[model samples]
Target: MTDDVQAVHQPSDLRTVIMTGASSGIGAKAAATLAEGGAHVVVVGRNTARTKEVASRIGGTAHVADFDRLDEVRDLAQRLLDENPRIDVLANNAGGLVSHRSETTDGFERTLQSNHLAPFLLTRLLLPRIVESAGRVVSTSSTANLFGRVRLDDLNWRKRPWAGGWLAYGTSKLLTNMFISQLAARSPIQAYAFHPGFVSTSFGSDSASMRVLNTLTGGSYGISADAGAVPLATLSGPTTVGVPSGTYFDQLKPYGRQAPQAKDRILAEVVWETSSRLVSIPSDL
Candidate 1:
């Protein structure tokens, strides 16, 4: 495992898992599987009714969080801290693609903020709990990461004209990969990010064009939501899956060919630094 020049944290049994985007799609399916496997699953969704319904079905705690709102994410984190003293896995699975670029009230690009910033904040805020339990952080990433182009000068996409959602979404996933890699390198906590393939879920619902694209291409080729969920669940804990920490996966197999930026230590540091500033946290933490 030359790719894994860095050592990994000690593995432990997984008992409780907190998963976002559990209202539907891969998140929802993973929730069911984890619960059945005897892990206490925490379900976070954007919609209230759907979240509760899924929680009820899985017998897991439910929290509503619109990733576009940083405050909501903070609140969710605090609530989880109060209830769950120790979490085994923090699966950052909540994210989407919008046809056009938008900004959150926090004044950041919606896609990046939702997909990357919110999860980074939650993970940082919950670092103590994760360390106490020696838990792993598994994020839902994508193969689009190979083509990611993030502008360190303009992460908000304010100066860069809206070039459509594909690039923005890819950049977000790339950042996720970098975030996981940096965290693995700097800390003893275990972390992994994965690509779930072209899952047949309402992934890009916010965009009309995405919906049309899904309708056209998804029907014949898209994998079922259940199929996509398997990778996250496999990586959740007790993995015979064999992918090392700080590594990205194409579905189940460890992929050595990563975007050059994803493996750049300097870029990873930059992403982490910028994320710390944006999340209103001290970098020293």
Candidate 2:
């Protein structure tokens, strides 16, 4: 058997967790670990077969929906909420870095749509259930946010030409941070952004720019997917306390000052408003 199929503990009392990008990488590892911890994890991904495989092996349910597709993400959230109103955790982990400039069916930038908009929409859609259950919302961020620059004028890369995938990817992370801050202020759900610490995942191998970065670093800088899952899993635990909402973390250690762009409330609100218009949710939901 592959090493990736290693057994982990399941969540006992933590019965419900909605994990996106559960097909592979840190998301998959986190889903397995949480399932082993006894949580009835709902795995969401673009690929049905792989996500189903992970869910089946972990004794959890799988839901297939592409985050890059806003309508799909919206539908996924509604269906998930309908299936189980007791969802206790929302792990917004699905994201990607397209090598070239692209847009989703919603006409939004692919990275922004997947990493920011979809998560934003899904969280808003499922927030009532999460808050009803007094659950936490954990979104994945990266150290790349440190170097990210938000091009507000050209958020879609319409004005500026495609520089590289990393630039757009980094900006998306920054947007995530900004959104988290707004959530902390507005939502009852504890919101946070975490750096999984240079994860060694297929994402890097799949992108030419990341491949070069990985090779230059001799792969020494990357952490195992399980290692990255440690801190994420911690946030989902019941014993965790005093976790400052909107804070950034790296392996249980609190990291700070992601980037100037990440603190732009105006940008965050703009993104939030734009996202709200894209998805249809009940007035208080």
Candidate 3:
């Protein structure tokens, strides 16, 4: 058999996988790895050409949709289910820092909407399909989650002066983790959050702190996006069956202090409730 044929046939039974922000960076790497392993990846991104390029390279399909928009995410989820209902894995990997404290057309904070609310709605919309496949939902959190407080009083950051991009970005990731824990507790479908560590990717590169770090230390502490995608792919794979759901991992192993706030069941419920209200997701989902 030819390599091309093998690539096409390799996870022949693993029908579908969905990866967000898959046009570039760690998300793209995860899509490639999963595709090479024989999963039919549905690459979601903002750029049609870039998304198609990556999708073509992986012998997969591309769906262009911006994560910063909740309506777009809802449309993407519906289209994905209409095309292929039984997605075996949903990788919520699309994330990054926004340059300013902006709001989406839907009126949510840009970073918070993209990193947390978008995925939350996407997951809820697709929850039935994932449950049907008995598949895993893998979310890409960050080491920065450790620094977040998830201020419910200022869920939209309305009262507090927007401290910085990291503040919003970190809070979004922490919300992602909180959502995972809450989902795991209530639903049959398993969910997980993970930190890939500081890979030599474009993450944090556009930030003021990173600019200073780059200036002072030559921007040394980084690993390739390929390295960062490894553990993400593993958790999304079938090998992770039986592992406890809703736990956080760093580089494929369990990680983080599970800070008192992180473990707060009430907080997780509140976060999910607020998330559902903001995104208009069905409570049952």
Candidate 4:
């Protein structure tokens, strides 16, 4: 362990959890569950009012950040480091499905940047503290990963024509799994990625097609947000609960089926290296 980890040691019962995207949907619900279970939760979201509301309701702290911008993500990480001594869990759950192919101010594809690269930067920035605390990293991946195909050379989808952005969204989820796998391999901290089921939440609200599909399903095609958050809460808790590191959960089941590409170690390393450059972080981190 590093000096940073040793300086902020606390009892196991008083775990400090940092959950991104906690303003609504499964993230908010999971944050509440963790708080109810006695963890000190730090709720991070894009919207100020909603983030503050969730934090106040759960007796947690709120920090607002837009994932589209890497600088904001860095600031969020710095603030987290300054405010907390030890971080027991870092939930990389803030992401969305964009309606069209667009680039963020950071010059990366919107979906890829928001979903994968932003969280990647945050995790790398906070790695030392988390490693020393023996913390876990939990991410919200998806069944959409099955539809994903990652072209390591063009993660931003610049060369391919946008097919209504579903492919981009799917690829981002696949990247989530690869990130967890690589982090587990390289670090001492436990890492997990899970599919929360097809959840009926405000997710994909920006996409008209997704909205139409959700309306047509009438909430029948998926589970509720609260229901979808169970695995997330479970994985992020203090206890390891017998699940090995780097396991991807299909809902609640460990070692769930994943896209063959998601399991390719070489490809995962490539993603790590590529993402490190994209976010201007050290690849070894």
Candidate 5:
């Protein structure tokens, strides 16, 4: 984070917030909270029926997009920009943990692409609009970051046999914070990243490896889905609430702790430059 980037606290107007992964868990709960407060919510999720149901419940806009496909992400960005003249908040919440190491059709690691690259590209594409609206971008990260480390050279783990599935998931979360750190340094948009703790949701039920890991670790014993949502909801609340830009939160605490590297300027630059290259955006452009 840079000193040039300052927090612009605005009055709490009827904010138009866009929350991804709104079909379930924390995203869905955040959408409900914002909408109940008279703000217009745009609910995004991979599932068609559930997303529509959630949108219907809050009278919000629902859009289906699979982050595994970059094409869908691009289309989503286009639709949001075209339909909504102003976007007050963007929640980069849709992500997953793959049980096995794999790459998307885009040739990027599944967990890394879904959790980090997709949101990076989305924020870059919508940055101008976000600046115009003086909006905030709240990203959902994880407390599993304690077990995470970033490998700039082997970001996708294509060169190593030691890369496990959980490693990829953890690295993605760490990378998200690094991305947010630099993003705040270079831009004036109010942005925040948070760890929602271990929420009790069927987040990785599809994977046998993940299921076994969850059982052994009692991953389902954490707080409820709604409890994990408070941090995000608080950060996304009216600017009058007073949260510093580029800060990482542990649950609802504004100045919460993060892995040291997540806040490293040198590492943040490397991650930002590497990400821009991966997305084909020149750093100096």
Candidate 6:
């Protein structure tokens, strides 16, 4: 942990939550809710000022790292491991919709790397501590996953033309669902993915059309960010809530409709293996 990172003093028994994307939208709201409920929240975001602001408001610790770079993700993980004795819940809530096709410094498609690969790496690196704490992993997925198609051969989008990035975004969410399912199957840690509904957030603010639509429609088009955050905060709670491991939720409802590829166990296993290889982690971990 850095000296400048604000640390909130909380009860030792409080659950330690690491909330990514806590600088804004559903993630920020959910992190506040968790903190109010007496959890020790670790706020992670790409924007330093925004991340620290949220953390300061919630009396939580803040760390900033851009998901576009794998090195930053690794550094964030190490800082997390070094500071927290246990991580009870990891809310993989940091992701966005890229409007154009681009590759990160890590050499993976920007959307796929930011939304899936980065979270994948963070979870795997923290697996041991999370398992030791008998923790849970809750990811923010989407109904857009219904349109996703994952091709193992073209995971990097090197061979296919980008369909304006929605396809890539959907594919990343599908990978999220599959990763949760496979993680639950292979490990004792409870893992879940959920669709937060069409939230009125800056999710697709990278696109000009989306910005215009959001401006014109406002909150009428979708639920508020706090409303969309309810499911995430709920699922982040105790395991006794009866949500089974590997469940994909549409808001609060379990077993939400998922794409065929998202539910295929064999394909999920392959995805797990391939993602592990891509991120240079152990497949079996």
lDDT comparing candidate 4 with the true structure: 0.88
Error of 4 at 187 (Å): 0.3
Instruction: Name every residue pair that clashes in candidate 2.
Output: 9-36, 9-37, 10-35, 10-36, 10-37, 10-38, 11-37, 11-38, 11-39
lDDT of 6 by residue, 173-225 (tens): 99999999998998998999999999988788778767778779864678899
| lDDT string, candidate 3, 1-285, tens digits | 001111222243556888988888888998899888878898888877788889899989888888777767777877777777477889998878875688888888888888998888999889888889888899999888877778887877777666668777778888888989988888888888999878866666667777777778676667878898898888877675456888888777785654457888987888888888888766655
lDDT of 1 by residue, 158-271 (tens): 786665688888889999999999878877788889999888777777777666877788555579998999999888855555656788888888874577888788978988
Instruction: Name the runs in model 3 displaced over 4 angstroms.
Output: 1-13, 217-219
Q: Ten consecutive residues with minimal summed lDDT in candidate 2? A: 1-10
RMSD for each model, in Å, please?
Answer: 7.3, 4.8, 4.9, 4.5, 6.6, 2.0
- Tens digits of per-residue lDDT for model 5, 153-248: 898888765344777787888888888878788888888899988787877777786677688877866689889888877777774547568888
TM-score of 1: 0.91
The CA lDDT of each predicted structure is 0.83, 0.78, 0.80, 0.88, 0.80, 0.89
* Candidate 5, residue 26: how far the Cα is off, in Å: 0.7
| TM per candidate | 0.91, 0.88, 0.91, 0.94, 0.89, 0.95
Model 4: residues with Cα > 4 Å off, grouped in runs: 1-13
TM-score of 5: 0.89
Of the two candidates 3 and 5, the one with more favorable TM-score, higher being better, is 3
CA lDDT of 76 in candidate 2? 77
> What is the lDDT, from 0 to 100, of the residue 187 in candidate 2?
80
